[model samples]
Target: MLLAMALTLWSSIFLIIKVGYCYVNLSRKKGTVASQSSTHEGAFLASRSIDGNKGQTYRECSHTALGHSIAWFQVDLGGEYSLESVKIYYRNDANWCPYRFRQFYLDVSNGSAGSTTTLTSQRKRCYKDNTTALATPPSVIDISCKETARYVIVETTYNAQEAIYLNLSGPVLEICEIEVYGCSVGRYGESCSRCHGCSTCDIISGACQCGVSFFGPNCSNACSVYCKGNLCNNVTGSCTNGCEIGYYKDKCKWTCNPGCKNGCNRNSGSCDNGCIDGKYGIECYDVCSVGCISNCERMTGTCMCKKGWQGEKCRECSPTFYGPSCEEECSPHCYNGTCYVNNGSCIDGCTRDYTGDKCTQGLYETSPEDHGTAIGAAVGASIFVVIAVVVGVVTLRLRRKRDDSSKAQKDERKESRIKYEKETTYVNRQDHSLPGKDHSLPDSHVHLGKRPANLKTQEIGLYEIMDSGNGENKTYENDVIAKTVAPVTNTSNDASEENGNVYLVINESQLNSSHYDELHVQN
Candidate 1:
């Protein structure tokens, strides 16, 4: 008996706690009630339904016109709220309309409260009455409509097919009171707890339904800063939308590889499309080798080497290798096995007995046949030298013979000049012997008969000699031609008594003064 009493006391305490929870009657005088055409506009207005009265009298209930094809009654909760349940009290006074509210449905809408058209169009049906045929409809009904809305509506429609059993031409809806129980928006549960950083919550559990910028159980956490639209998964806190530029990963917490173009993969940070210039590898983080002709392969970083470069990364020249692809071997003659990578030339000069730029020539490897060829060339060169010497000697002898002949002719002319001088002296002495030559002429005094002082005696002699050999009728004129000098005066006229013969007579003094000592007679 004591245990039963204790159990009863505990139950009593639990009931008091349940009643203490914070839900309110959202449709009781807290909202504006409305309906389709009223039966009597002033007497049975829609406002009577939510007047905070549970009275079943005609003046306390809301009534619709009798002939309404589809009748509707609704309440505006003034603001959005989470609808938990709806308790409706139907008209029971005088049994005037027992079956009127039988075939009805309850719905909630989040549409515009200013126009009932939006409320009807966007309504979500919550409950429908399924009463038996000819059965008495209940005076009061309770419906669980766990929905978030601003408008709570009840609708009833007439069906011609069911008119035979329902005995109704159309639907006429009347209600004594409507008690909607729920919490305000963003709050939920019997306690009406607030849901932080969210739009709404579950009515029974108070679990938050996060907004675009929030995540986590209570929607208290913000999305990652790199998330595209601040949208993320509520449970995991990962970005649901993509990340911003240069960012990646599920939560958009990691940055893209620096060498990537556009961006990188969200899962692995790999550059999918391609890498930037000179970059390689999946993440585009590795650089191409310096010796690469262009960029390396995206996955391997293998370089297409430039000239004289080799290996996977083109980082080094192979041992004893040089030139294109490093395929050509260095010269064996190179000292210390070292050579230029580009041309395989010796870098430290040649080994012993080797010569030339690449150190490939041998110093003492001549054959007997080569020696014989060298001897033959020497013999031929000697013969050519001897021939040249002999020809030069013969040419020198001919030149000396011509010079001696010219000297002999000059000596003969000199002897003839001496002889002419002696003859002239004799003639001059004979002249002195002539009678009546009292005045003795000076030894230096020489005369040509009336000749101009400008006339050269040697030139006159040459002209006379040349003219005699040619047998050309050339006369001594005052004008000298380019080839010879002439007598300035007419010597032939002076000697006209000698029968038109031209004569150059030289006295002893003339022979001494004149360069030409020979006497000439020209006819």
Candidate 2:
């Protein structure tokens, strides 16, 4: 079934193929033909080659001079065209010489037909015949040129050796007929349809190769105005790279919402980077409150309000206006009808019968007796507070005085102790001296021992002397042994008066009297 359908479809397409609609032969008596030099008294002029005749006789062929270094035959197609193919019918006569058209080449150019500079400098070689041998070659040859030009030329170089071998004067060109098939500029296809806004196109399909600012099969459609460079995909008409700022979508046809910051999404037209300040919503089209200090939440329209306003949209006045809507009146009893906007409180004192900061409390709410009692209570509380404060200050001063007095006593005792320590000079037996007396004792006699472990340095003196010791004075370094001395009286005599008594320095007040008699009796 599919094969039958395909055959029917192809039959319909062939039925529409118009007759006589092939690409035109641009060289068929339509262009002026010329050659390097004519021969046989103009019998074989170059015009005969393009006269739509393929006869091999001298009347129908084009012949050039025999003595030229190179021979060329050319035709001017009158206008430039995109050439598709070319055909050449060589002369085949009873006295045929294949060497006459040996090693020939065809060129196409936009230059003039026979100008030396145009032929040599501006021509592009499109076809060459190097494979034909000395035997009779094909009578007709077709070449696929596919070039764009206004002139077509066939050229061959003269070979001196081949010319001598063939018994010819020089190289010569003979062509019975030549045909060039192509479409006019800006047109293609067998029917020569126009390629709108295209400089080149496929000759068979009519598909155009469009330039900038154009697209589509025939390149007739223009790119969108919002496109970045007026450029787009040639087939789909979509801007492939990106759209201009504030534009979105494939063809950049949709305008972005004004609230979008930089641009929008190319596929969805949503603000990808969010909205500008004071705008919200998916496309950033919703406006935020005028009182908003900065941008709002893009999808929610929530914003931070400025001073004096509140609420999500910042449409309501703040609490400074007495209420959320800012419509509540101040207290009527306020002084001069004026009050603070924040709390609706009187700026000055309240009027006659009113009381309290806001002037809203009435004096009739309480009796005079009750008011007086309240005042008396307040005054009594004040007096009690003052008495308590005075008592606390006096107690603090008495404590400080007692502490100072105790400190003075301790300072005096410390000074006495330090003085005693300085007065009690230490001496060994070797340093001891006295006049007419042996003050030095044996090495063991001057022995010193550690003070009692229970004694505190600040509470007791290390060395002490007492009047209870013998009349000859003595010093003891240990506190316990010093208390063991017994009382003695000095005799009033001349020898005793001549000697001085050495006493050990002591702080008598630091000693415990209760333990003294026990120590004395024990010693």
Candidate 3:
């Protein structure tokens, strides 16, 4: 029971204050002790040597054969564990203790093959009695056990100096109780149940503290199932870092197919880089039928066939074309050897008695009888087109004339006047003589005052013009108008220019700059 109390106290450091739970003593029930030699009931009965009396007897401990240089006391802990630490209490804890080795060391073993070298901390001397033999090996000694093992031992050596100091006595190993702590990794609870994840769980409660690349209640499940190369969070189970290529979703549950553009979800897989184009559903998986212009959609599987092809599958002849491969072969009576694929309506039109799909149905025999009707129709259509064009042109000219008349009324006064220097010569000479005078102005051929009625049909000329002054005839550097010209009259007080309604010449150098500023308005 000394071992039980030790385990209860040790476990309290790890669980009790928070959980009020205790651990079991690994060396109590099934454990037994053995030594290098036997005494009384042998080392096996020494397993109960908690204090001094409970063991077989006083000197009946695990004593070595006399003259032997070394002795050992080993205890089987029954089951393998990630041995945390061990505490070996001395057998005789009374006033004058017996069976204290000069010095000793502890070791452990894990394998079931019973190999001896499975121990560590070789010969760790405890309470060396070199200067003077120890009164009694430490009542309690602590040993750090970083190894995994199911057996523990207390072994010692007897040297000459220590033997002589003890009056030439041989070595003997004894133990009261051996206390071991800690359970194996991944195993926890009172019965040491295994957890679900790669973690160390609460030994008493069977709770898990997961480690790298693991998840679930006991940290035994792999998180890479959906995450591919990544490890999901132990608690959240999300591949927060990222997912593998060709796999997508919150948990990377969906796989990307080649039909998807750049393998992404565009408009629920409709268009763009995120979309996978096709008929969208069942028809999308199947190949388009032969003679199809475009693939079938959904369940119809029909297509927009090519020019020569027809029907839902686009395999038969079209309305205008005939024969296999839709070669348009009209009857000889059908002009241009072309007819409608649907009813054989000739491209150049059908003959008199021939009328049907491909022109196969006809009155009498289709013997070139339809050519006369075909030629007459084509000529009639051409004649109608010519007449329509002539009518269109005449109508357009009349509309233009009406528009021009209105504009003339609005702009007849847009012209101004310039007085001639002297009697000037004019061309396209009409008499233009005034009724009140024998001659027109100073020159006979020159028309003035009242203007010529049809200036568009007449040509006239002027040598030079000048400002309102009796000055010599002077020419301007610029040739303002070279074509037909007509004499004009102006009675306005302000200086004005006389010009054809179609031509207006402005002299920027002559007009005051301010005039331009005021003139810049919307036309």
Return the TM-score for each candidate structure: 0.36, 0.36, 0.29
Residue-level lDDT of model 1, residues 1-523, one tens digit each, is 9999999889756754775634777765434555544564557888878776789877788887655567778888777788888888998888454566676788888754235442254778888877655664688888898888888888777443344355545677778888888988888877788865567877777767677777677788888989988888765678887888789988899999889989888888888878998898878888887778898887888877876467898866765677656767778898987788778888899999987678887888665558899999999999999998897788677757955775667656555665564456233334442232355442322222344445454333322222323467655423221122233333332344422221234344444434332444221
Give the candidate order by descending lDDT.
1, 2, 3
Write model 3 residue lDDT over 9-33, tens digit each, in one string: 7865665446433344455445433
Work out candidate 3's RMSD over C-alphas: 29.5
Measured with C-alpha atoms, the lDDT of residue 498 in candidate 1 is 26
Write candidate 2's Cα lDDT for 1-523 as tens digits.
9999999778646644542337877876345555544464556788888876678765578888776677778878887887888888888777665556767788988875456442365888888777555544466888888767888888777454556766666767888898888898778877778866567765656667566777788788888988887888766779866899999988999999988889999999999998888888988888887667786778987778877667987766654445544455657787876666666777777899999888878888775658898899999999999998897788677757965875667656555544443344322324343334445432211112233333232222244343222448754445553422211222325333433323232333433221221111111
The clash numbers for all candidates, in the given order, read 0, 2, 16
In candidate 1, position 32 carries an lDDT of: 56
Q: Candidate 2: where is the Cα deviation over 4 Å?
A: 1-21, 29-41, 116-121, 132-137, 160-163, 196-200, 209-523
Q: Candidate 2's error at 137, in angstroms?
A: 4.2
Per TM-score, what order, best first?
A: 2, 1, 3
Where model 1 places Cα greater than 4 Å from the true spot, the runs are 1-21, 29-31, 94-97, 112-121, 159-168, 197-199, 211-216, 219-523
**Cα error, candidate 2, residue 283 (Å):** 47
lDDT (Cα, 0-100) at 507 in candidate 3: 27
Model 3: residues >4 Å from true position, as ranges? 1-21, 31-44, 49-61, 93-99, 111-114, 118-137, 159-168, 188-196, 199-523
lDDT (C-alpha, whole model) for all candidates:
0.68, 0.67, 0.49
Q: Which candidate is the best by lDDT?
A: 1
RMSD of each: 21.4, 26.5, 29.5
